[model samples]
Target: MVDLNAALRPADAGSLQPTAARPPARLQIADVSLQYGGKTPTLAIDNVSLEVANNEFCVIVGPSGCGKSSLLYLVAGLTDVTSGTIRVDGRPVHEPGSDRGMVFQGYTLFPWLTVRSNVEFGPRRKGLPKAEYRAIADHFLEEVGLTAFADSYPAALSGGMKQRVAIARALANDPSALLMDEPFGALDSQTRTVMQKLLLRVWEHTQKTVLFVTHDIDEAILLGDRVVVMTARPGKIKAEVPVPFARPRSISLVLEPEFIALKKRILGLLHDEIDETH
Candidate 1:
């Protein structure tokens, strides 16, 4: 069994100073709820609250229709909440801002642009110089291992490759936090695994706070520092499980007994929620 103590110990203080010194951009969600209105008003999320610290990789998981993605969208300011508030570093989030970056399940690339241009889109919109934005795009393209495909259009890339570009484009904006909604759900299992590992590498290197939503428990366990489980529709926080396995993790870690045990615990929590709904 891996030593939980060692796994949970804080990263070296000296080595972490660079990221630590940056202004705090902790994500805070307080008493948040979302509803849709028409002839039939539907409550999708009910008083859900979550906080993701800067540089933390937090994943949300729940059974289908549990509003996991809805909660993320609320934080991204893509949709307004019916009640409560969300703040980043103490500033209220009223709408989408450059401070928050989003990546969706679909590769939302600009079909007309080459990979390089797509990645540079955000920086360019911010009025960055041509040379400066190009350099930023180049840096993230290399970070995502797509330097060779910089000139390729979205249609020319594979699904996994397209998602890599999506990731690069989001990072190029240098958002305070990254909000991803099932970014790899459409990929094959092998490709999904590769992308998961690639994301960990980039997260560690960039130290960006991430709030990712997925239905895959294994992906949650493999990638998150803490996995937030939500209950069935009108979703609420069911449990928060800390992933104590050390970082620099591999896919093989999933086969470990500890990993399996943790998976079972989370599954039971999800099952209980599903059972309640039925």
Candidate 2:
């Protein structure tokens, strides 16, 4: 382990370069909490903290009404955190900004706009030149395998296809973080599986930081680099599980014994949390 004399020789100026430490976390949620207002207020989330490394796929899984989506909204800057902070690259998140993109469970595409136009919407609003937005939309459409459908309206596309457009639209913005809230939860099992694989492909290609929320344990395990499990309503992080599987994962990997074991563990904890909520 000691080659200090050789290291000190450094004869080639072109070959020697200092290596810096890895950058700080790309997204950080520090002691965040939230509440819904009314005469009788409801606490939706409680003292949650988590981090996603740059270009990591981090999934949050929990039982129904666990406030997973609520936390996502806070990160997206669509809602305010009652306490603590949400930061991206060390900048505090206060309001919706172009730095983040969102894909939701429902297909949030504009029925009136064509697929390409829908993807172009964000850049257009930012007043980027037409050619630039056109290229941006086209590139992401191709990435999502939707290039051929670029001219079609949302009303004419299948649910899966429309969601693909939603993903493409989000990515077209070149956001630093991609926030997803059960984006495929509504699809049938078969379609959902296909969408999951497609999403992995796009994720590999783009390498953008992702924070995805899902109640599906299988879905969580299939995609996350690390899975953060939350307690039932008034949710707080109950556990954090790192998925040790290699990347470019496939649906078949779900059948592996190791995968099954991890799923069982997460499911056991999640089931306990659900029972506690009841």
- Pairs with backbone N, CA or C atoms under 3 Å apart (clashes), candidate 2: none
The alpha-carbon RMSD values of the candidates against the true structure, listed in the order shown, are 5.3, 9.0
Write the residue-wise lDDT of candidate 1 on 38-132 in tens digits. 99999999987777888988889888999988888888999999999999878999999999999999989999999999999999999999999
Global Cα lDDT for candidate 1: 0.88
lDDT top scorer: 1
Q: What is the TM-score of each candidate against the true structure?
A: 0.92, 0.90
Local error of candidate 1 at residue 142 (angstroms):
0.4
Tens-digit lDDT track of model 2 for 84-137: 899998899999988999999998999999999999999999999999999999
